[model samples]
Target: MAPYSVYVRAVRLALEEKGVAYRLDPVDVFAKDGPPASLLERQPFGRIPAFEHDGFRLYEAGAIERYVDEAFPGPALQPSAPRERARVNQLTSILDSYAYRTLVWDIYVERVSVPKQGRAPDEARIQTALPKAQLCLRAINDLMDDGPYLAGAALTLADLHAAPMFAYFTLAPEAEALLAEQPAIKAWWASMSRRPAVQATAYPA
Candidate 1:
């Protein structure tokens, strides 16, 4: 594993928490091309996790999450039904597209060795992402209202996406204050972080 991408780490933790037997296949994504040659065969885009088991191949985080949920006999990771499952998928999309992608970049923009940093990652960028993150929190709050889980009473892949990225966000100076503004989000973050699986994998070693 190239250390651990926040998303990858969350999925790994989800599997662990659910007690699903899984093997971590470390693909060298920084190699000459994207990932290793073997991985390329499974993932045309050469993503880090190209899941294969029982002679089936799967790619993308959502697909991988679904496969893990189905293949493993343990706590369900998604709600049953087209609509509820769609909601879960939608939450994943919002996290990947709207919240985490940009919010998680705050530190990188402020700290990394990029040629140029747009917006200075200053108050402006931070402020922009904060509301967007709150948007994610609101959706999560609504989804979670039905039960403890984002999809329902059971922990699902939606929580998997939310928890770890929140890890990155809290590392920022204003994270607590920013998240504190959203009561449901603050509570949910607290709940998810307290889970044993989440606690073990949240911080980097």
Candidate 2:
């Protein structure tokens, strides 16, 4: 009943934390799952987490997250400083654009570049991205100065990024190895994954 795959649970937790009432319309991502007409009428990308609030439509996970936080506002997410807010948005973009999909590669591509189908993924994509993921991890480390939190001392949209990915990249045996090198990210992820709101909302698909 949740629109969430493990990938988008953070949005759900935000909704729950804010105490917003809504229904979950789970979108099956594996095999072209969407409403009969076209997902474009709902979400142009045919992606999950598209919301229909009283016939008003919206898309994009981050936009949905910010909307929910603003609309409900029980346990606020965004910080006051314009710079801090910029950092939150910036880190989210970096994660979404570069780092988010790579861990899936490390999984679906069992040998790190070859899928179960025996066909190889683009060697250039992996080579290009692994280093980028490393940089993202390092940037996360640098973000921890004010505290372990990403934007500042408080939990902000930065922590939302972790709740969604924990079950995915994490279940892999290699996840431990991946975390070993990235101490800051590991600490941030572990700390957040243990929080009461996150724990309560995590249903693991």
**Which candidate has the highest lDDT of all?**
1
Q: Clashing residue pairs, candidate 2? A: none
Q: Residue-wise lDDT of candidate 2 within 91-141, one digit each (tens)?
A: 788768756776655442444335546786676665565666566667766
lDDT of 1 by residue, 33-135 (tens): 5577787788787666566777887777666777777778888778888998888888888888877666577543343313253434465665666666667
Model 1: CA > 4 A from native: 31-34, 107-128
RMSD of each: 3.7, 3.5
* lDDT against true structure, model 1: 0.70
Clashing pairs in 1: none
